[model samples]
Target: MKTLLMGTAVLAVTASTAFAAGHSVVRLGTEGAYPPYNYLDDAGEVAGFERELGDELCARAEMTCEWVTNDWDSIIPNLVSGNYDAIIAGMSITDEREEVVDFTQNYTPPSPSAYVAMSEDADIAGGVIAAQTGTIQAAHVAESGATLLEYPTPDETIAAVMSGEADAVMADKDFLIPLVEENSGMVFVGDDVPLGGGIGMAFRESDPEMREAFDSAIQTMKDDGTLNEMIVKWLGEDSPRF
Candidate 1:
């Protein structure tokens, strides 16, 4: 997941010293690009499912939180560098990622990836494909017969398809479905590609206590049916339940 320049970038909690000291306020980081997960509204404030869920999680944990937005490419590295206390981005739990950062238990279960193309007949297998860099979809495209075009942001991946740079884009279905429904030119093509584990909050390995706090809060949401209600409210009534 960390594809950027990696040097002596030790996981220091300097950026979140207050949180490390068990302060009441913790800074939460996110990409603010993926829709229905984390994104900035017209007011430039964080708003989405993860935002609502994260706020509730913090409230349940009896802590105050502030939102920090970072690029998808550097989201993890910034977290490892202690740019924030935890990553509330829609990050998947993968072994490769686990090697660099510890993850709270998944809040959302594994979701399927899908290909969005200009037409239903587009060549998804042998044509060029676009995906955000450092993502599971990018790795999948790298291995597939189709040529892979990596973008720093999720919007660029979609733009690549719209501008004829790529035949299709591969990403989480939840992120693509809305775009497909809104655009007459774009439509879901090919079969679904199951990629990555569920979405989870990421924290420094040295901050297990913070991770546990959020983890327990998430479990409480699940036990009390609040999580599913939020999911259905933001995602859809048919969204997966706990």
Candidate 2:
């Protein structure tokens, strides 16, 4: 009976260790409003480049990942609070953000962010440009002579330009390219100043192990053509720095 009890205790310890090792779920967060990065599809499902990329990364890492959506402004704070493990939003690796959270190596390369005007005759060469609120692009627009009108989302920015409420809307090159292609009246006059290198996954400074895992997964995706394929699918062949 003593030997049997000892054997049962050993088995229980082994089972507990296995359970701990198997708990490999990583919670990823994103702003569901950003298209080509992450967005809600017509079917109300989370879909977009970042969503696909996250799914692929989790698969490669042999871990389960759960995606949660939140307002763009709240993403970083939520990450800091441990509400999620990482942010796959198209958030740029800016110096200001670096003060708050650690970022993985950029998966997407640096691309010019620009303003597009809805009016063919709108002279944006020396006019006002608008950008989404609280973004690096907004800072760039403010520097220009154009008065910056900050919106909460890209859709609002686009609407402002479309309705003549704003002279132009500023956003990433890849994001504006598709909008220009689809809308005949809109034109991308010139490239705005480059903001930063590129968008990266962000993690809290406290979670070094999670950050390392995410960085490793992103590098693997980049080396194996996964990242390139995703870029092409979402941003087209002319996408900068594919």
Candidate 3:
């Protein structure tokens, strides 16, 4: 459920040349599909929480920045290959990913992963469960007793359940809450599973300076309570704070 994607566009802001002299433009890559986090608005421009946060962080760091959209599957690889300077997608900071790229301090805390189904009695533990591929939720299902049905996008996983191909779907609780409320038939089932450490921006292993700049900006937001406020504003009142 923690998957989504969309097209690319660039938005740049002029910054203080005194603070950013000689610094290259920092490109922040996102999926531009996941709502309340990163998504493309009607204008085909990247919008939502991460967009605002990324912009603020760049401003604070005195870096001119641009937003880039890429498929979720290639977000990280693109960053490493210089397609982008950092990844601001809703990517969790996991040990496995750390082996490939460095991560800044978490911007959002880990939220519980839950199951949604047509019936509350769906066999979440042993039935077919759909999850977006390459996500922590998919990894969880592979290790759970249930059969894992993988999809490339979150919409497809929801479609799998609607078509009766899967007994249930597991995804971030925050992402599913709005969907379950909108659909009368879908209901939550089984226990809520917490996955990943939290969400963070990623940079290639060689970009320690970029990583540290963003990390410091994130910490400043945390200390001032703005990060927590943004978390609640987009994720809901029950979402965990920094």
Candidate 4:
């Protein structure tokens, strides 16, 4: 997960207004930085697992959708303020978050968080750890014995480890796997930590109908096996499904 301020302000539109009649335009918000989940393509448009999955869900729900990018930290706040309809970012479903926004049935199963360091000998439990701010990994580190260093972006969390500002970086195993493979200096350390329930789309509390529509669309994908195919395609064949 990551956060960055959008260059322009988006017109506020509630799900009730935008998604009227279960077949109207609904703006989908995401952090265009988390790869294999959501990220910006070379064309500067949002791409990755979320983009393809969101588009399919929109079509299945008979709704027109537009993508919007928002800072991850302010994503929930902006959703509450009506800047967008639903958040399709790789957001974890948690009681703490549900108290503020409503979540659809989970699209992805629970993922494990892992640590990456320059050496296998790194002290994953007691050493300083870097994590993207506002993410479940960050919360886990804050509670763990390790010193927690928070960053605004996933890249920065990796940077903190590369620069030795922190002994290791903690993030979703899916996100860290490719990075670890590409970087000769980085290696996974510590046991994989499972946190949060699963990933889901988030809507305002007042938009129960809108949430239900997408939830049904998600279930359709699961039933047809399309969701699992997509998950394996982007998140590796070993990724948890359903």
Give the winner by lDDT: 4
Ranking by lDDT: 4, 1, 3, 2
Q: Can you write out model 1's per-residue Cα lDDT over 88-128, one digit (the tens) per residue? A: 88898999999989999999888889999997898988999
The CA lDDT of each predicted structure is 0.87, 0.79, 0.85, 0.90
Q: Give the C-alpha miss distance for residue 206 in model 1, angstroms.
A: 0.6
Q: What value of lDDT does candidate 2 attain over all alpha carbons?
A: 0.79
Q: Rank the candidates by TM-score, best first.
A: 4, 1, 3, 2
Better of 1 and 3 by TM-score: 1
RMSD (CA, Å), candidate 3 to true, equals: 6.5
| TM-score between candidate 3 and the true structure | 0.89
Q: How many residue pairs clash (N, CA or C atoms closer than 3 angstroms) in each of the candidate models, in the order given?
A: 0, 1, 0, 1
Candidate 3 C-alpha lDDT tens digits along 11-101: 1112223223457578889999778788899999999889999998998888878999998887877776667788998898899999988
C-alpha lDDT (0 to 100) for residue 72 of candidate 2: 79
Q: List, residue by residue over 1-242, the lDDT tens digit for candidate 2.
A: 89865664554344334434665787889888877778999987789989888898888777888988888767787676656678898999999999988899998888778778876566565666678777888887777677778888889999988888888888887778778889899897764568886988887665556667778988987778888988888867877644
- Model 2 spans with C-alpha error above 4 angstroms: 1-22, 120-126
Q: Which stretches of candidate 1 lie over 4 Å from their true place?
A: 1-21
Query: What does candidate 4's lDDT look like per residue over 156-241, in tens digits?
Result: 99999999999999999999999998999999997999999999999988788899999999999999999999999999988999
Residue 39 displacement in candidate 2 (angstroms): 1.0
